[model samples]
Target chain A: MTYDPVLLANIDKKDSHTLPVYQSGGGYRGLRRALEDMSPADVVELVKQSGLRGRGGAGFPTGAKWSFLPKNHPGPVYFCVNADESEPGTFVNRVQMELDPHQVLEGTIISCYATGASTAYIYLRHEYPLARRRMQAAVGECYAAGLLGENILGGGFSLDVHIHVGAGAYVCGEETGLIESIEGRRAWPRIKPPYPAVEGLFRKPTVVNNVETLACVKQIVDRGADWFRSMGTPPDPNDPRDPGSFGPKLFGLSGHVNRPGCYEAPLGITVRRLIDEYGGGVWKGRRAKAAIVGGLSTGLVTEAEFDTPLDFSAPIRAGCLGLGTGGVIVLDETYSMIDFLHNSCRFFAHESCGQCTPCREGTQWALEMLERIRAGRGRLRDLDLLREIGETIGIMPGTTICGLADGAAWPIKTALGKFREEFEGYVKEPTTV
Target chain B: MNVLDAETRENIDTIAGRYPTRRAAVLPVLHAVNDRLGYVPTEAVVELAELLELAPADVQDTLSFYGFFKQDKPQGEYRVWVCRSLSCAARGGEELLEYLCEKLKIRPGETTPDGRVTLEFAECLGACEAAPAVLVNDTLYGNMTREKIDELIRRVRAGTHHDATE
Candidate 1:
């Protein structure tokens, strides 16, 4: 790991979750700097220069997202910090919210100021009760200390931060779905363009950001934009659209690893280094069979591809979805590929918003097919059918409203593409008999 | 006929006021009622509609979409959610859940006869690092083992709570 742990610095301290403990270590100094010395546009410019990407799967450029709010809009612009860490094999937001909530809050306040958002909401997952309690308390502390709500630190800007808890829906993690949930509606994600930035949350412009993305905003002010950009990959000058993964990321390492926990490492760290150096290596002296590139939705990395860097564009080069929440789950050799695909497929099936027919029905059908294969009743031709379902369901293919179909498709594609023999061996048996 | 009491109604109104539209306050309002009343009664949904100035069906429309709300009846004293996602499943979470069911003499989503616990299969509690993790009501117990589960069940049965390791 080339970078020291920045976000997790105060996590292990005795009273880390408390505001005093956080502030004592120059916590709000970034907020103070932005509030006292700089303009809101300055903050946005600095972030744009830093090349920070969203940590919540999409890897969208944060500064670009902030700049998307229509200039001088007629209505209230909202900023929603997504703390809904419901992705399978992911818990980065939960740890940050539970242990270092003020960091997230400080980043949130700074982002709100830069984006001209007068109202902000921390959309916390319902399952995370502990994170909710601590974050709620931290919000109160910030309100009391003039860091949030009504002329924050006398900076001539005011923002109201509220905690809106989710009710056990993974779809709520999707930006538009989050907006819908907060509006007291069923958490079905809306179709874009009048994207959230234009018309969202009571038909007004809104900015939805990941918890860790906002935390990065606070650190960018503390450290120079150059310092933030120095760590992760720079833009591929060849690809104009590639914004390049930058800064330290909270990589949640789990499954078959000795030291399975959240680690703050730079964006370009390889799977080998992350597993051996930080994760204490695969458990029980077993060889790693496959690794989820970054959460189940991102798909799997074969043993040969373990050397691939986990940066945003690198994962795509490694034939998976972009670094989707940086949740790396290593599966040792003893683990079954059938189990892996089943769980990944099942999650997408269960969590699909059910609005889009291809994602809703397609995911369920795929999962049922996997269950049949697992139950020793699958045909040799069923694998091709599964692939066909996956290929047609995602937004990229124009079959679904959201990227969820794409997320569900990945593991199936990767598992079948890379670990086909394992799956073939399982299915070939029932077919021959 | 009167489902929401004076205190509950006041609480719902306070929650409803937080949002721009009463329709938008349906979730937080229902959460508050669910937290206090154990489960949201169908009649209370009607009361909340009147309070928020929406039709009862509108409130119910949003209410039924989310899985956490229990409209039929109150849940058991404790809700033990065993995660069965990839990480946890790889690390004995499936077996642990089965062990729990066998010991409790009830399948998942069923409450024990004594009304002490409600076992459910959680997708992922975002505690993958602590694979084989279970949430005993609101507290997440990470690095869970059968022995740890035994202690947890005993504690819950005894009507007690313990702090999660920091």
Candidate 2:
């Protein structure tokens, strides 16, 4: 695993946040190369060839997303960088922003060029004041260095980058919700068919990407596509259509692990290795019981399932959601699954935007049911009710405006499905009320 | 009477200039007010609406959606937020919060009688890598322990806790 580091190479360097230090370490070289040597179409083609996917939860292909934009659109195109890293177990984006703000800026400039966007916005989470300060400083540096503003780097490409801090909403991580938030409205997700590429952020063609995804773009431009694709194992070995997951991915390891920091590895690294080798095994010399591969929105897997590869498709094949934000939460034998689901449900209920009927109503009901069970007043049929509610909210397509409801429902269904016995143990026979 | 002071109004105007539309600066303007004034008063919302060219109701609607902005009254000098999410909870985050509440003689989301410290539970500060994290004001303290809490309270009371902004 002696692979060369790309995104995190300069993360630990002294004064890494400073523009001079970043430039000395070869920062903004991608922007330089893109602006001077490559065409906007060439940059997009390189990204497509590199097999880079969104580092945010969804795992959508980055280049393909850019390709969806209608070429030669009349109005101004926009680029919204999703720095609102609010996923419960994820902190990698915050680290990237804090340590190497210039890397994110470089990647963003490249993305704006590739997408034909003249204006860019970084939707940062409000809780991260340190990250915000660093980003503000870095953007100022870029503007002073002539890397931003009109005619950047003496090239005809011009882009304006602004930092828009989100007040406190998890749904804003959703692209359309982020666009709405940027528009000075509540972060309610818009329906697809008019995706961001078609109409976003003031009804103009927009490309919204996550922080880590944009950072990877800088590396993809610096190194050739084949060089970038050489690291990670793909989904299908034989078929190029699958593009198998490639490049380095940052895994946010936390909870009960001895070392709970963000670790970078190839996309298809095994979960067992990540937990034992990189995480330094479970804390207090305890054995790991279950693990949440991605964020809280994803399902839990038992210790036996630890062998599953950490990729977008591998975890889903193992009956969980894809590699979402790469936020791996480990639960030891001492932890209670019941309490875990309760906390997760509470977050969903509080954060749901109340846009759609099912998500608004379903999340609250699920939380109520979980609370009742935790209080030892749970009926035997309540488990069945929980299952039905989760399935109805998540299993059905077009049930809600965004995937928040589905994110709310998946953990409930998966937690109950795997830990039914633990849930059953908490159930009390109904006493006549 | 204007809820926002001259400096806050000027700061809000500057932020509004960053955006193409004045309405897009609502959150940043509110944040600036909260940073300076401690809480967003109803009068401030009315004034902000005039600044951003929106209705008072529109400002209030956006303000109500987010829990970060406190509208009722000024917060304590030190706002202590204990992370109670799963990762932090696993590593004594809840116990730490309970301990603080017992020592401070206040429940979560309540300020002490002295108005020096307000205790609250945060979902996740994105610092789970250092479990049982606590955020006082904007700066986050990680791997927090009982002794650390005691020291923090002492510093806040002594008016010696290092302010991130300063």
Model 2: lDDT equals 0.88
Q: Please give me the DockQ of candidate 1 compared with the native complex.
A: 0.78
Model 2 has a DockQ score of 0.70
- In order, what lDDT does every prediction score? 0.89, 0.88
Interface RMSD, in order shown = 1.5, 1.3
| Angstrom error at residue A401, model 1 | 0.5
- What's the iRMSD of model 1? 1.5
lDDT of 1 by residue, A74-138 (tens): 76888899999888889989999889999999999999999898899889988898999999999
Task: Write down the TM-score for model 2.
Answer: 0.97
Clashing pairs for model 1 are A183-B24
Q: How far is A307's C-alpha from truth in model 2 (Å)?
A: 0.5
Regions of candidate 1 where Cα sits further than 4 Å from its true position:
A430-433, B162-166
TM-score to true structure, per model: 0.98, 0.97
lDDT of 1 at A259: 98
